[model samples]
Target chain A: MKNWLSPRSTAGIVLIAAALVALPFVLATGGQAWVRIANFAILYVFLALGLNIVVGFAGLLDLGYIAFYAVGAYAWALLASPHFGIHWPVWAILPLGAGLACIAGVLLGSPTLKLRGDYLAIVTLGFGEIVRIFMNNLNAPVNITNGPQGITLIDPVSIAGFRFSGSSEILGVTLSGPQKYYFLLVALAILVIIVNLRLQHSRIGRAWQAIREDEIAAKAVGIDTRNLKLLAFAMGASFGGIAGGIFAAMQGFVSPESFSLIESIMILAMVVLGGMGHIPGVILGAVLLSILPEALRYGVAPVQKLLFGQILVDPESLRMLIFGLALVLVMRFKPAGLWPSPERKRELQPEKAGG
Target chain B: MAETLLAATAVAKHFGGVKALRDVSLTIRSGEVYGLIGPNGAGKTTFFNCLTGLYVPDGGGFEFAGAPLVADAPQQAAARGIARTFQNIRLFGNMTALENVMVGRHVRTRAGVIGAMLQTAATRAEEAAIRQKAIDLLHYVRIEDRADDLARNLSYGDQRRLEIARALATEPKLLCLDEPAAGMNATETEALRDLIDGIRRDGTTVLLIEHDVKLVMGLCDRVAVLDYGALVIEDVPAVVQKDPRVIEAYLGA
Candidate 1:
């Protein structure tokens, strides 16, 4: 136990945990805006880390990942919200949402198992669009998704009679809804990190890496690549589902617009920009990409007003331009990503010595 | 006579109009070094692919240890105790030499996702055992010092031997080596012959596809000659060398 928790790592863990635990209180003066942004950043970390399993570990390109997110959110909303009239407990529906998302993942993964690379990407992209369109049009036929108007009045998360959506005083400290959700999200994210780390060192993880390197060789060594790929898809989708459940409970709303193609691309970007297979790198990517836009949202307008004496480009537009430029620069300078795993670093080496 | 460990009967494969393998039948006795030799495009590699289930044979079936073989994928074949190397060397290039052999130990190891995630006692013990076995295999191949290096970084001879070490990690009853001495110097070829001898002595049947005539003639107890997707002759190396059909198949009668 002592060896596992070396002093330096123990110190680092304590420092990080304390900082995270104190963040909501520290941002109290800044209002809920900062806390909400942090919430979203952590949410994206869930998304990017989940996607790393498929794209980074399994080496499957899935552009329809947002479809799973939508499935999860809707699963939570339809079960716990006013639209469905079910009012299931948040805990009960969360796992169901994740399971539904896993099924969706497997369904999407099966047909595309034979497709490689870009073809797989296109199919997943279509699957994502199809889900979004289904959500948009389902109201007329069955009112299943409540269509474009979206599902509203989703129930807040409650565990053992303690409501997370409503404010409560803990040790004389009043916690707001977002702050409470923030703690829960942090716990969930930590769980994800642990799971991801364990998986990366496992036999399945090694087989996935071998498949990524050479499918034929992986098969030769007796790895069931087809089932493993589906497992990757399902596992990754489950995390997306959990995040979506949290998103629905916190926001009390779900809509087709929230699960758009751009959201999927943004999640993929987070995975690629951070460092594809590395867990820490993916979290870093997710946090940076999530918060950077908000930072740009506030900084760009003022900078533009000061530099140009007029609004040359809106902050949103500037954010896109800078984001594109950053991706390009990163690709050119550090294709392995900001914090590439040693394996990924070797894989992306410009010129391998052996040819 | 030793029991026939592997008996492939009239195996056939074709690609559109081109027959890659046709009517190829051979039996490998337990604990014997069996050689499959042929010219370019003689379907030696294709035959290996069929046995390993990379390609489904159009006809014929196999019996291993008197049990009808039903494996239809490489993984299944490996699981059933038949491991193979590639003619072009298909080592997982990015993985370390030890890791490559560890992957070869996949069929023998049984730590699934849950066990791996929890790092249970069984999983840990299995993984440690696999690592030790891989290291031992590397040592057997005389490349234990290069075990930590990436497979692609190893020298050509070491890489070829590494492939053998990897195949041996499956604890296979029968090891199929595709041109194990390919691109090796005469000295390296001699070393590979000794290695095959050692493998057979260790109770594994050795089935090899080699283009090196001298190495095959020197090392094989019995050799099978393939020409134009068909087996022309199978006999002792001395008898095979003198056969008119073998001579004609090699020199084009």
Candidate 2:
């Protein structure tokens, strides 16, 4: 506790909080697009943190994690959109989406409990594809999901009568839809971070790490490895669910294209690149990965034109090439990650530690 | 005579065509160091795994503390007051030495996901107690100074000791150690002997599997020798050591 509340850390916390609160306005000065990107970045933060629970903490490679996100988004779309002629409150729907995603998580996890490494990854990959396909095709039979056209006019998150979709002036400052969504996402991310921190330091966290280190050893020590693994899946999926719900409300839409395999892989890359099992590192990874592409999208074309008088490659293609190169270089140099957990750093580089 | 603590009846296990153990039985009384010794492929470790629920024996059952012990899983075996250390030193390598032991207390502690996430007062107290107890177990194994070190970074002998410390953290009625001194030097083996002696004196029955005949002959109150998955002999160490069948099994008659 004393270590946690040190003056330096307290000051750091206050500074970060101030920056987070001011970020939207700062981005809005540049352009509203930046704030939108920031909102997505926060959403990615939720996905990365949630995946970290499964892949980082429990050592379970989950490649179909975005399925839970799909589940949550569809839950919101079905409950609050005109497609179903049903409208549920944000609070009511978010929990339901999270609950449904958790059940989906358990369903996906139970069959793959006996697998490890590549096998588990393959199974999860299949699960993610299955969910996306279900969403894509479910429309044909019952007019559900709108068949890739997506459900529109979804209700924005509202409390009492104040809608997030509309601008509101508070304390001489006006908050736009994206800005309001940004605050909501940040608040939720903070809550998720707190939950991750608590779980990391508690018995459940220790058990997960133990299982990650050696499942047989963990079982020998009296840990119910099967149940704990399922718990990891459920917990991680619920976070993804919550993020998906918020994403649906923010976008006012839902589509199968939005929950693709690439998205799951990208979220996984964020967890791995930022630092698996480390909260700050994961958040950093999420923000960087989510924002970097947009930054490249906007910056690449102009910079190419200025330097070479013409673009050598399309900005979109160039952005991806640079992104791939950066990932490769980071992996080659860092091996563990950009901000690896101390234990993982030591585990991956035993020779340097003289162990 | 002390009360019987564990009894194995006609335990049998086979893998395809290879018969690992066949109809081997043994009894261990409370408060004694029991040793199991045999030649290579004699099924000593197999028997240990079967008892500890790492493997399900095709035939046989165990009576622990006068109850039918059906441990289909390792956690069930642990919850039934049986704890064990692996022959290959399977400590949670990335975790701190103390944390490795705290994990052993998982069966004893009652905090679930909600309790942990909430950090209820009782959960906090239990967590603290678990930590203190783990530290104590490390001290008992003389690795208290290495409590904060990652289990993987410790010296080989210290890692073995840490495994012992972790097993002891379960507060088991019976503790089993498989080849604990496998890679130890002479001095380390002597220290391990003292640690096992200390554990037995602390009122936990010990079941040890060892290849070190001298150590087994010296430390065990009673020893059992297995030859080709059959019981060669079971008696006081002095008697078993002199038995011709045991000699034949070891030197090949």
Candidate 3:
């Protein structure tokens, strides 16, 4: 049964495809709220996949990943919103946002490429906070981001005169805004998955993993480590940018508050909890974490009422406690993660064969 | 009479007040097993580092294959067909034996990000060729059966041989082996000697550093002795073995 759902199997592919196709319809019956949760989950999947490239493949911990996301969102918001009065199309603005975010990635990566581990993490954390604070305080200098008010009425995604902002009927199937965004996210997520898969098997991918394992050995074997590290950051940030642009267009709102240190940590947690360097594992981690809080928010109060005839603990606090416990337990028992990559699984083997 | 593959002239390096290598020079002829023997702190590894571009000499330079070696980085040195193994084994422990060798073939392969992403027919063919070459290298090192095994899982002698196989994958014209048989038993050491001979027999110049005096004397076509970071003598094995300075250097250290 487990093997049937394993990503390597044909049955698993079919099952996932069938489920993805049916999910929107299933949630549509219950209204847009569940679909919105799924949309956010998909967004987290995008963020996790992007973070996976840096933290997973390249073994570079980037705690400022949300900065790129923020850059991408701001780029989209400014270009396609009433705040700037530009109102560009989604296609035109998407690449620009991604490109700008990529530049930010390179800017951060180039200087910090020499730094590793906790030092790099601390620098990136600072970069993320700096970007947020800059965005927050930019209202006075040039009225760039409108200070803390954030951009509103951002333009929605439109493809070939078909706006995803409103309900649209396709083959007698009516799709709501959340449903439409869910499909788009799934499509983008699939594309990202393909990119991730291709990279994981490529020479560049091998070089990245080799750098992760041993940078000195990698350089000794002629891997141009400096450029490759930049590429990793750029590539990883590009995904974050795409996700950010989509997020801005979907919500029709952009804010510095949205891209916070917590967002970065959550994304990093998704990568770790899923299985660093494992694509499906990362996706699962993102999906699980994204849904877990919402599920707790809706389910915990009712469950508490039933168990004790009154609420003993607030859902928010309970939600965090459960999340923290889950993380700790997972780290303790399954250190490689829920779905570890083959190499990582070998690394975390119960008793490694005696040398 | 043979063409000189590597010629180091008056190479010098110093760490602060201490001279790690002072005026050390040697000429390695094409297709010869050259041995460099020295006691601890004799600067043999330092000279090896200088030749391999891991360390830039404070003064002087070396030429390889009739061109002045401009190896500011190890990659540049590798591009010039000079490959060396570490005194301690440095195989990528996480990777399989086959994958480790493929990394060594990285300089030889030229699939960029686009080609890799697109997985074009050319890239696919190249990747296959690389895998094939890597497998052949494993077979060459007599560890073909353990190709899929993690490098760290390999026995000590196998790991040493794997390092050699990896170095060979670079298709180097000059292979510098730093204490390749350091941790091996007598049988393993004998096997390693044969493998090193086989490597030189395959038309590659070999430069070796070893503490095993008998292995140095028996295997090296020519031997160079260093004392206090300076070359004491460069002669045939018999001549180097009997040198008073070499004897004194070994005993003193």
Point out the higher-scoring one by lDDT: 1 or 2: 2
Comparing 1 and 3 by TM-score, which wins?
Answer: 1
Residue B192 miss distance in model 3 (angstroms): 0.6
Query: Per-residue lDDT of A300-331 in model 3, one digit per residue for the tens?
Result: 99999999999999999998899999999999
lDDT for each residue of candidate 2 in B1-253, tens digit (9 for 90 to 100): 9999999999999999889999999999999999999998999999988998889999998989999787568898899899999988898988989999999899999888788778789999999999999988988888899888888888889989999888888889999999999978899999999999989999999999999988898899999999899888899998997788888888456
TM-score of each: 0.97, 0.98, 0.96
DockQ of each: 0.67, 0.68, 0.64
Is candidate 1 or 3 superior in lDDT?
3
Shift of residue A123 alpha carbon in model 1, Å: 1.1
The residue-by-residue lDDT of candidate 1 on A3-49, one tens digit each, is 55898988998999999999988886798888889999999999898
lDDT (Cα, 0-100) at B182 in candidate 2? 96
> What is candidate 1's CAPRI-style docking category based on DockQ?
medium
Ranking the candidates on TM-score from highest down gives 2, 1, 3
Q: Model 2: which residue pairs collide?
A: none
Output the number of the lDDT-best candidate: 2
* Candidate 2 TM-score versus the reference: 0.98
- Which regions of candidate 2 are displaced past 4 Å? A351-355, B251-253
Q: Could you give the fnat of all candidates in order? A: 0.66, 0.73, 0.56
